[model samples]
Target: MIKVENLSYSFPQKDLYNSISFTLEEGEHCAFIGRNGSGKSTLIDIIMDPEKYIFEGKVEKESNCRIGYVSQFSQLDKIEETTVFQYIGEKFITLQNEIASICSEMETSSDIEPLLEKYQEALDAFAAINGDDFEKNINKNLNLANLNKCKDLRISELSGGEFKLIQVIKEMLNSPDLMIMDEPDVFLDFENLNSLKNLINSHKGTMLVITHNRYLLNHCFNKILHLENMELQEFEGSYIEYNFSLLQTKIEMQELAIADNEELERNEKLIEKLRDRATTDAEGARGKTLRVRVKIHERLEKRRIKAPFIDIKHPNFRFFIDNKIEETVALKVSDYSVSFDELLLENVNFEIKSNEKVAIIGPNGTGKTTLLREIFENNNPSIEINEAMEVAYLSQLQGETLKESNTIMEEFLEAGLKTYEDVTDYISDYGFEEDALNQKIGSLSGGEKNILQIAKVTASQGNFLLLDEPTSHLDTYSQIALEKALEEYKGAILMISHDFYTVVNCMDSVLIIEDKTIRKTNIKKFKKMIYASHFDKGYLETEQKKKLVETRIEKALKEADFITAKELSEELEELIKLL
Candidate 1:
């Protein structure tokens, strides 16, 4: 349905795409994946309207095709006062008016046979397009997004998640021939992300999604369009297959490049030796000159192979302990009842031991961040912290919190540093070279800002760390780097993040906030529970049986009862079948 040929674009610093070409057939669902600062978003914008950019590309859409787009950061803007009902109602204005007119005609007219036929046709059309059940589906989607309570609220009054939900719903309602979503996974939590995955999977129209969320790519898309080093490559398979093939291809390319470079060096060295021999030996000078010329020509004709591009850098993070902490319990929360106009959590209790790493997970807008802040600020009476513990909380990166006028060097110095020399090593750990230190903070990209936030939090050097979505805007490489650092951190860590991959990699235990209650589970058990929940409808029953059998088996083994242990193992096998 969409074809892009010889697409080339460039920014002031570098080329984003160069002579890249791709095509999307009718009903094709493809995912665009790349690291941060890649031109995924830019390419989507250009595809939406080629005239908007001064680029060398021909983007052709089938004539009369209506394209719908949901931007990553769409806002209500001047329509903030619009109500949810009114906002969605606007899409079906004509149909609603027609239905009302037909009903009015049937109510008052004496000769209603002609009107009856017209009304039946119009109603059928509405029903076919789901116009008749629009309100019901709206409520269903609102509940999925946890915005059912805000169905009557104005756009201005809605939370961030609700706004994103409205935008997604609006685009879905349009039912355009082609739908384009740029980084649609940004603000979604687990529940909402699942809803979006289902939506995209059920969509019949063509789709192009640019996202870094592996869960979405794995479930929603069937094709992969990878952008790397100003080139575009298409893979006709799942993200898992694409990732594996990409790594293998890169390794092969690197080997080929190394062999080519070695051969070129050898030829150049031989040519130099032959030239020297020609000058020293008068008898074979002509023969040596021809050999030298031939070798030099061969060297000139050889093509240089570029090495594979891999941008993985390690981040050096240090957490300093100011005082010795011998307390076994780093933090304890008991009888905690929290509410903000609604009961978010009630009568919940949990504890974090010294050097324990716990991940706080829940649906979006479920007060995970609020819980962390309450602990960090010590504002809740139900919470307690060890007196010897020093806490450092990493806030979410919002707008430009630093002064725009200051340079990166100046901002680091503002963190109570004596001089730039003191934090130079620290700054380098964030991938910032000395030249970038003089650049204005305002000029930094979203990914750069996220790295700076991590650096700032690390500078605090507290043993008890509270991180809220620390990997929010980081790229794949940076996210992995951050995860590795967190794994090695010798501090009491409690973090609220929606990145499930990072959570599984860095957290040893999980504190789940669900239905106004807190549930504790170790990493391995939690992973199995989630996997079963997705696959089985009888998850709770299977989980209970598995737990009971495991407990019995452990006791039997401890008591050296071989017969009982063997019986319990058989029971466990049967229970696994149920799961």
Candidate 2:
């Protein structure tokens, strides 16, 4: 639907691109992707003709084809004064104006034949863009984006995530022939992101999305536009193909360098032989020439430094932390609820037992962390907690239980842990090196700090653990290593995390805080609820729908995998009876 020919752009110091070109087919969903500093955003801006970016390219399209572009950066001021409802209505008004403009032009024309043709063409274009659903789609997608719930909420009051989603819904309603997005999944999680994928798949138009999340790339993209060396190339494969190509190219370059080094080595040996023959035998002038040749060979050798080949493949890691739990209740709350002024959660009941590794999962601002903090305060109404119980907390920002000037080793020692062999063993066990031990806790990576905190937990005498987004900043390897350690933990565990891999591995049961209620369900049952709820949402339908439904059925087919199989059965029975 959109084509760019001989696209070129550059800066004063560098040529960003030269003769880059691509074609977006009528229904192709293309992912415009590259590394962080690869000028992906600049290309989108160039295509959209936003501002005065220097470029030399000719973008041609089907005549009068409407294009809707949603960039990553939100323009708050552009729509802040408009209410969500009014903004939704504006989509219809814009289409109506286009229709009226065509009608008005037809009335002003003298030639009946040409004017009638022009009016018909304009009307066809309008219909082609599905102008009829402009308002219906606006309201439907707006509600999906939660703009309906925030009707009274001003644009200024919207959160960063809410604002991003709002604009996406607005752009979708425009029904452009082509939609362009950059970092479209920036603030979205698994559920909302799946919603976007469904939207893209259902739309008949073309799309070009630029994003950094590999998960999104793997799930949604059919083809990839890999940018390298100021050129454009069409590769017919998923994101995995691009990653493999990048790896192969790097390996090939390293091998070529090695071959070049061997050639230089052979030349140096020849020079040495020539020098020895001239000096020891006859030909005095030849000796001088050979000496000069040797010097040249030395300079050449100096220019080509032999570097050890490094193969660095960052493997994605997913950790499993679940170990069998002891059959004893570690904590319990009956009819639990907390209210700050007006917000109240009542009739909440849940239990955690020894040896059980559990997590409280929910969306942001859903008060998952608040529930954890309340436990430390003896479920107190207003009193804040500080060292209320023998628990360790890792907040979302990882801004808890750490201090400046405190070495990892010192912190471990201070935790009242068992005797250690200079703290290196403990740190290394969690995947940190000896060098990282002496470093102040302030500058450590999130993973490094997480490892240290895990070490602290092992060293301390605390039997019950309280963690908030404990795995938030950890890389896959560190997460898995910690998970392995938790598998053998003698005490109970409680965490609030959105890391799907980690949670799936470690959690025996789930404590879900959704829609202002707390519910306890075994991991298998919770997984069923997620799928059923998704199907209930209307995104997963047809074959995908059948697959999700079948998977849930198979899970139900299995006997209880956890200790609460009987309890879950009774819960299901009660739910069925109510229905």
Candidate 3:
């Protein structure tokens, strides 16, 4: 129950929002989406505390409306020793303890009236949160999330994904009127992501989630708030429906654009003819007609169609290599094992041939990142690399590849970029603005940092790439671009990813880690396994059909076969409804 009207904000570098407005109605589940560094999080901050930001907007909330928030990056360092149950029930426990202390003081104090008042206030606060059912509620939520086993586990014992879910449950248990989660699905594994989907679906109050995960986008939201090009579009429909509408609009706009261009060409020719006639005429009538035609041409130019949102600026990702190793195994892992306090992976083995694109996939805390890092370091006895192969790594933790204190230009320069001009020209293809070159790497958004990592890795011109969660913080557009880039790459790739779409679209095969061992599976089986585990039955088949139809539509449009394109678009609309 909040509304923003006529909102506009800007930083010194550029404008962020231009008179954007949207409303979060009661019980509405809205997905907030946009490109990286588009100020989605900053807008959230403004909504959370309007007084903290100086902007032109009216942010109004219902009186006494309670709100809960989960930030993009949440760390449990301070509460690492607390149990999951204790963490979730901290507020209930505090009120309970306070009430108990006051009652005990009332039993032996001369000022019993004051003690009694304090005890009543504590009880009221506790009851307001349904404290009588606190334990039961906690157990129910944990079971609902399939996290009952983690109730007694210390925070330090949980995986990052599990801990994030716990934080979400903690906020939900507070029973706030509205919840705002910023990229809550960032690093979650497939199973945990499914649990998150269920949680969002079952939520009774309003929610505004910022996420780029395809699974979540396809399954979770009833409304979509797309922020692009400093403008906001609020669509009251499923994400699939919204996407279909945008596609239909794009097609219509293209048709109109063609007609408009044709009209402009005709007008220009007529204007030129009139000008030529004026040069040859003895009277001023031809000159007057030419001036009138020139004004009409200018008006037509002003009314020319601008590209739609489908043409939003996205990084043009390209991966290059210095040399190719033909028909040879680029990397091999033989009887590899790694452990930290406990055995995480044992007897793991995999190989990547030259020009092969493979993905290493598993649940959280399954040693995917560790294995990728070890492979990149090339110090393990069990790991082997071709002598001529050059390696480059993109770590999930950006700090591993990028220096925090260095500016974007300085970082590239340190990476052997010859000059500032060279760095600027190179990063431009990766979607970095020229002004961004002077900003510290640490100040960039998560998606921006990930893009920088990819740019740096590509610049190395390595024939063997070890990528750890390369798609983690990227926007959907960049993710698609990366899939295309990886498909076209003429090098070996061993990537660690939890993104099902990326793995399915880009990789030829998968090395799955389970039960402390590694096994290989083809892309078809991987697709089936993922659908069976995380999605509805037959969903994959339908998606495949939809993808095929979409490709046909694109081909028809390119060949100027509007009839076939229209038929395919209608077919695609039906297919989207099935999804």
How well does candidate 2 score on lDDT at residue 221? 70
Clash pairs, model 2 backbone: 325-355, 417-459
Number of clashes in every candidate structure? Answer: 0, 2, 0
Estimate the TM-score of every prediction: 0.76, 0.53, 0.96
For candidate 3, what is the TM-score?
0.96
Off by over 4 Å in 2: 1-23, 55-65, 73-86, 94-128, 135-166, 227-234, 244-360, 363-365, 368-511, 519-579
lDDT of each: 0.76, 0.62, 0.89
**Per-residue lDDT of 1-579 in model 2, one digit per residue for the tens?**
778889888765446678988888887878775433346777877777635675677877788666787766568888787777566557567657876886787677776687677667766766765677766776667555545676656776565556667666667666777788887665454555665666665656688888655445656776788665576677666665554454334444454566667877887788778867786754587777777777877776666543221232121222222333346776777766666654546667777776678978665456666778777555554332223235545554445676757876677777664556756665565555565566677756444565556556555546667777665444333455556556666666788765554566568888877778877778877666665764344422333443343344335434323223333433433332331
On TM-score, the leading prediction is 3
Sequence-dependent TM-score of model 1 = 0.76
Ordered by TM-score, highest first, the candidates read: 3, 1, 2
lDDT of 1 by residue, 16-83 (tens): 89899999987888998766666787898898888889989788989977788988775778879988
Ordered from best to worst lDDT, the candidate numbers read 3, 1, 2
Across residues 1-579, which tens digit of lDDT does each residue of candidate 3 receive?
Answer: 899999999998879999999999999999999999999999999989999989997999999888899988988879999999999999999998898888788788998887888888888878877889999989988888899999999999999999989999989888888899999988888888888988898888899999999889999999999999889989999988888888777677777778889999999999888978899772689988988888998988988887537778999999988887786989889999999989999988788898888998888998889988888889999999999889999998899899999999999999999988999999999988798899998888999999999999999999988898899889999999999999999998999888889999989999988899999999999988888877688788899999999889778877767778788889999888888
Write down the lDDT that model 2 would get: 0.62
